[model samples]
Target: MNYAKEARDLDFAYKVRHALNESAENLPVATLDRLASARAIALSRKKQEAPAVALAFRGILAGNTGLSFQGPTSWLGKFGVVLPLLVLVMGLFGIYEYEQQQRINDLAEIDVAVLADELPPDAYLDTGFSAFLNKEEE
Candidate 1:
């Protein structure tokens, strides 16, 4: 069935090509010249297509996968993916460092409070000290 369909398509294409060729020969020289000039102009204005990989990778930074990547701005597209990831990693590292510094500061404050207390450090080691403090709170 597929072979029959393909044969019919091929036959139709041949017929159409023959018809166009026959008609093209009968066209006026002036009309043909105009057509040739028009074809040249159209071809000149036509955009050159990039390779398959270039097309897929092009303008990806701008969320446009269809447009071709041009010369100087091509680097911008390539850097687009890496830039955001680099920034994210840097931001995360900064947040981690800030948290670590804050934790160290909190520990330092606790140490300073302990050292500045009026009670002797030995009193804190006593098992009864907690019980005495709880009783005093009552």
Candidate 2:
């Protein structure tokens, strides 16, 4: 879509330039000379355009080049990058600890339930007891 639009714009520019050239050829010599002089003056007075430069970390890190990041705010910039990573590490550690605690609590609950039951603990180890419980479920 963009390519087609660009092609149309380029075609329109070429047609306009061709029309201008055709009309300019029919103009009087004096008028052509005045236009030429005006064009030359405009070109001569035009400021030299600065080269386009891309922003890069290499430029910032190196103190001598383009824009320097070595001033008072340099530590702040480093801290900005470090702070998020510190937070992520701490968050992950916290999540891990929370999961570990949940698993321990779940095991403790199961142990307490079994201990509180009226049946002898040895009955749980009997294969017949397990079969009887399965049958009871049916």
Candidate 3:
């Protein structure tokens, strides 16, 4: 991960490419023209097939053309980011509310059971009562 070494390597590669390009000019005129044509064709094909989302970024330089969203595309992009976070917060809130309701329902059921039984009210406070309720629930 040495950036200096990478920069030096890149510079060396560029020089090598320059030298090769210079040597390539010495090739036959027909060969050079064919090579240029092939390069142009390859670049055109690559550009046509490139994904839009991958290029949904600002230009490489200050004002070059790439994907720049406007109107609905811009709104959709912003909404795309916000929608998931909103859903997550709402989902968590719902789960917490559901849990609270369930706890309340369980307590209400216990209260009804204690009221409906024939046992004395004092027996409800006995330690065994809790265990008996657990066994009943199971």
Please tell me which predicted candidate would have the highest lDDT against the true structure: 2
- In model 2, which runs have C-alpha deviations exceeding 4 angstroms? 1-73
Q: Ranking by TM-score, best first?
A: 2, 1, 3
Clashing pairs counted in every model:
0, 0, 0
Worst 10 residues of 3 by lDDT: 64-73
Tell me model 1's lDDT, rounded to 2 decimals: 0.84
How would you encode candidate 3's per-residue C-alpha lDDT over 9-116 as one tens digit per residue? 999999999999899978999998999999999888774565556554353335443355523246555687788999999999999999999999999999899789
**lDDT (10s digit) by residue, model 1, range 1-138:** 999999999999999999999999999999999999999999999999985764454433555544446423466666876789999999999999999999999999987987899988788889899899999999
Question: Candidates ranked by lDDT, best first?
Answer: 2, 1, 3
Note the Cα lDDT for every prediction shown: 0.84, 0.87, 0.81
Return the TM-score for each candidate structure: 0.45, 0.51, 0.41
Compute the lDDT for candidate 2. Answer: 0.87
Query: What lDDT is reached at residue 83 by model 3?
Result: 89
TM for candidate 3 is 0.41
